[model samples]
Target: MLKSGFGPKALLSFACLMAPLSALAQDATSSSPATNEVIGLRANLSPADVRGPLNYEPTKGPLESFFPDCSVDKQMASELSEAFGEALISFDPENKEVRFGVAYKGLSGNAIMAHFHDGAPGVNGPVLQTICGHPPPTSAIGVSATAVMGDKCPVGNHGVLSGTWQLTDHDCPEGSDKSCISRTVDEQVQLLACGNLYVNIHTCLNQPGEVAGQITPVNWIGKEQNCNALPPKSSQ
Candidate 1:
């Protein structure tokens, strides 16, 4: 799997398996650059962008006011919760691009696909790129065919769900989507240029739309005004 869906326990277990970072740092000081690139979970928030404690803002539709507890952090092994979260999107300052990720667990079913839709943080938008496309599950509601970014849509569905049906230049073809290569680290930097891209997870139950909060840039590490003021949910 390109990315594993893990929870807090998995995060803790992985943390325990790795040597202390400090010890690793000492070992790296003597190694070549190829053996010592910086690595770990991080967000691109600035020192002042956040206000109160760390907070999440879901700006689009019914999710506007949704907020994740401030306690969630890189310590939790990728986002392993059902709430909205933030990450420091480090990218080329010149390009204004960065890759931001939002993870959600406990959706009605397995996450069959995910995307980085093109829209402002709080506003509605279209799917611009496919982030993850899992193979169909054998069980009921289990996904069968998955479409990746820049590929053709499956034989029968243009979208798993529908509403405004906002679409972008990169949506899959009418049908017959293809496998997607996970985004590369450098590509992550390129994807963040607009400072408006958000990460969304899609499950089999809500095929055409997101089942959780919309991913947005936090600018910093602290909380901001709540997003509970957006419009009512849209009807597809």
Candidate 2:
């Protein structure tokens, strides 16, 4: 059976109705510029803020570990809760490094092992750096010093830690009882430089690990070159 009385007029009306919806969809997608997906590391040591020494409060200063190009001015410390604070970072494709800044508050205890962890932001991944470690003088003070791991320095308590940190995939989880499982320091730094890891600070009470958070990157927009320069929305 062939029926054709409706004719071309009906088809013309249907085409017109569909045209606006298609054009609107195309315009929406075209209007917004897509942002590149950035890969990097960050940490929010909230729990550590309220757990440090009662008198040893965190001071605002320039942080270097998160990035070589950026200065951390808002780095905070605490020992009461696991939410110590956060760091803001930016990637420098030219120099193959990350620029960052931080501010911390509320420190209550002795600084323990701080390092970088590798994982997608906001997710619990793996270790990446040894910001603080035990070598040589195993005492609390000795290990806190900035000493390299060796027979003389031997992982100990008496040591120093440097705020300027570069993380690697191998430096993470800290060499096991058998052997270091992750990558090398250089590799970790390269990873961090390429935005593949985050920074985290730990305390003595929680030896193996403590509270942790993911590092996030934001666009640079300040002359002071500190965490304060970060956009207000960048902060968590």
Off by over 4 Å in 1: 1-88, 94-101, 134-195, 212-236
TM-score for predicted model 1 compared with the true structure: 0.35
Stretches > 4 Å off in candidate 2: 1-44, 48-83, 121-125, 135-196, 209-211, 219-236
TM-score of each: 0.35, 0.39
Candidate number achieving the greatest TM-score relative to the actual structure: 2
For model 2, how does the per-residue alpha-carbon lDDT over 1-236 read when each residue is reduced to its tens digit?
11121233322343432343234323333221123222333345454322222111123332233221212111232334423545544333333333333333332333344545454344333333334443212111111223122112112221222223322223323223222235554443344433445554544443333444455332212212233221111111
lDDT of 1 at 119: 41
> How does residue 221 of candidate 2 score in lDDT?
21
Candidate 2 — what's its lDDT? 0.33
Top lDDT: which candidate number? 2
